[model samples]
Target: MDRFVFAGRTCVITGAASGIGAALALHLARREALLFLVDRDAGGLARVAAQAKAAGARDVATEVVDLADGGDRLDLAAAVEARFGGTDLLINNAGVTLSGSFEQVSMDDYDWLMEINLRAVVRTTKAFLPQLLARPGAHLVNLSSLFGLVAPPRQVAYATSKFAVRGFSEALRHELAGRQVGVTVVHPGGVRTNIATSARLSGPDLDGQQAAAAKAFSEKALTMPPEEAARQIVAAVESRKPRLVISKEAKAGDLLARLIPGHYWNVIARVLPKGL
Candidate 1:
């Protein structure tokens, strides 16, 4: 099959306000893609829309909606369909992080993270699946994470959500085999994003430790630039690659998980930076 093209294609991206999502918006814009950007931060969403327009997007639309809310997800999908007519590409990039061990985290917070990270992706994909089927050569992208590959301490909620994304994307790819639509599940390493700093801390007294760990992880492990990650993702989309793992750290983790599925974390803990 021929590779996917971005120019003039209608692409819907969630979490487009900042980080990898914003960088992706700009990257696709330079390719002249029609963009529908979504995020909860109105101000940041507006800024990205303006930048997307300036970067040469054929057309740009912005939606400020909380993906964790089912009503908002449905409403956003309807609005996108109404305005864009149809979507050629759907990128489920919105995600949140929860810090603390499983016991330290509350069920409410865990559910909240799941709502945005996994449920939102599933719901949005369901909403747009018809459009993707109707359009020839359409594609879907889900942003999983390095945590998706490796299960580590203090990241139970995040790992669960990301692992679910990875599973969903892989299964969907199998189901869509030989179809016009394509699926790509992304496993990005610590690209410098605010997910760490802005992570919701669960335990009451563990705030200081969690905060320090988040800071350390962001500083030491978040080595790749969002722009670079965006470039790699766009390239993966063009090739219709089923899986794209970004950054050396993520790649290493993926390999380790496969090599020692029973105890990868044993090695990971030893090599991982302190406080993380």
Candidate 2:
């Protein structure tokens, strides 16, 4: 498939304040795409908007909407409809991570992460589907994680949410193929995001060691740059690829999952770093 042109295309990206979302906004702006950026962090959103404008975005709109709330997501969609009529691309990039085993993580933390990662994706996508359908050559991108493909020791809540996203993206892709809309499920390995520092650590070792370990794991194992991940995501959307794995580690994990199926835990336990 030919690369889909972003010039004059309307793109809405949730969680546009930082990390992969911010990088995607900048990259898409450079491509001359009209951008609607949304995030709960008003300050971070402003900074990204300024950078996007400076990067050559002709039309940029930003909103401080928390996707965790269904009402906020609907309002965001209304705002998009009011400003640009509709969007050609919807990137579901906002998500949170919880650090701990299933037993260690609290039910409240699990619910909170699930609300942001899975429920928000569903709500936001549903809110924008009408607009996407009206536009020609629309694309949907959902961000899953490498953990989604292969579960490790910790991160039970995060993995569960990502696994759900992966399933949703797959089913939606098949359902939308005949409707002129494409879906791409992204599995990013690490990509230097603040999710580590901001993650809720819930273990007995919460004296700060768990948080530090997560940061270290992200820095060492998840080394892909956010900008690079954004570029690849855009490319995948353009090419209409069904699945896009961002890093070498992510690719390896996917392969391992496919080969091992029900036994990847054993392999991962042996291969993963001792501290993590």
Candidate 3:
């Protein structure tokens, strides 16, 4: 397989323990990039690191840091700089999920989700972005969701965070355009990652609703494999694409949102089953 010219780059991927992060790390390893894998789960990060090294990473390492903690993210950057000098690619892939009515959402749940989903992106980017700018043609990848493009019924906090991510990515891209940094905002549709299975749903009496949504979600959706999504994202950066939609469904939804504006929500509304 012909790989992209990522051979000499130092790639830092957050949430690298599993899901798309692990897959991206694996793909980049095949392209011979140096990998700095970050995740709160130490054991999972170790597994990803071993896979990257086995696959073909020039050098592979791991950092166990909870991105939701601002102080932890700072320490993580210090460790990265201490170990690897500087990064050529920084991917903000760490995220969490929440589902409930905005009014029913607890303050703790709201704050925790915000910290992980939105604030961590800001913190990690601020920490690693300088290293990226110092190098020529550096890259930054922010993993926004299809929900970020359009609002849905249940995911109140998650939607707000993704919206922030989408806006931040665009703004950062423009700010860094004339400079050497490149920013690619990724919007992936339903991916066959364990995120849904592991997601935390809130609301005092919403457990039944959550279970029903989970069931419906698994049924009607065809989640593309994480490997395929990872490939699309890496390819986008190599090709200098500013915005990337990982699945055909995502692309269609994005286009529809653009074409009819508010009507996109109507489509989603119609698609929703009773419980979800």
What's the TM-score of every candidate structure?
Answer: 0.97, 0.95, 0.93
Which candidate would rank higher by TM-score, 2 or 3? 2
Candidate 2, residues 1-276, lDDT tens digits: the string is: 345779989999989999999999999999999999999999999999999999988799998887666563677788898998888899999999887778889987788889999999988899899889998788899999998899876778899999999999999988887888889999998688888878887657737777788778777676778999999998898898989998887888899899989997787778777665
Q: What is the C-alpha RMSD of each candidate to the true structure, in Å?
A: 1.2, 1.5, 2.6
Q: Local error of candidate 1 at 195, Å?
A: 0.3
Candidate 2 overall lDDT versus native: 0.88
The global Cα lDDT (0 to 1) of model 1 is 0.92
Candidate whose TM-score is highest: 1
* 1 against 3, candidate with superior lDDT: 1
- State each model's CA lDDT, in order: 0.92, 0.88, 0.84
Q: List ranges where model 2 is wrong by over 4 Å.
A: 1-3, 203-206
- What 10-residue stretch in candidate 1 is worst by lDDT? 70-79
**Tens-digit lDDT track of model 1 for 1-276:** 479999999999999999999999999999999999999999999999999999999999998889888753566667777888889999999999987789989999999999999999999999889889989999999999998999888889999999999999999999998888999999999899999989998878543888887888889889889999999999999999999999988999999999999999899889976766
| Candidate achieving the largest lDDT | 1
Q: Answer with 1 or 3, whichever has the higher TM-score.
A: 1
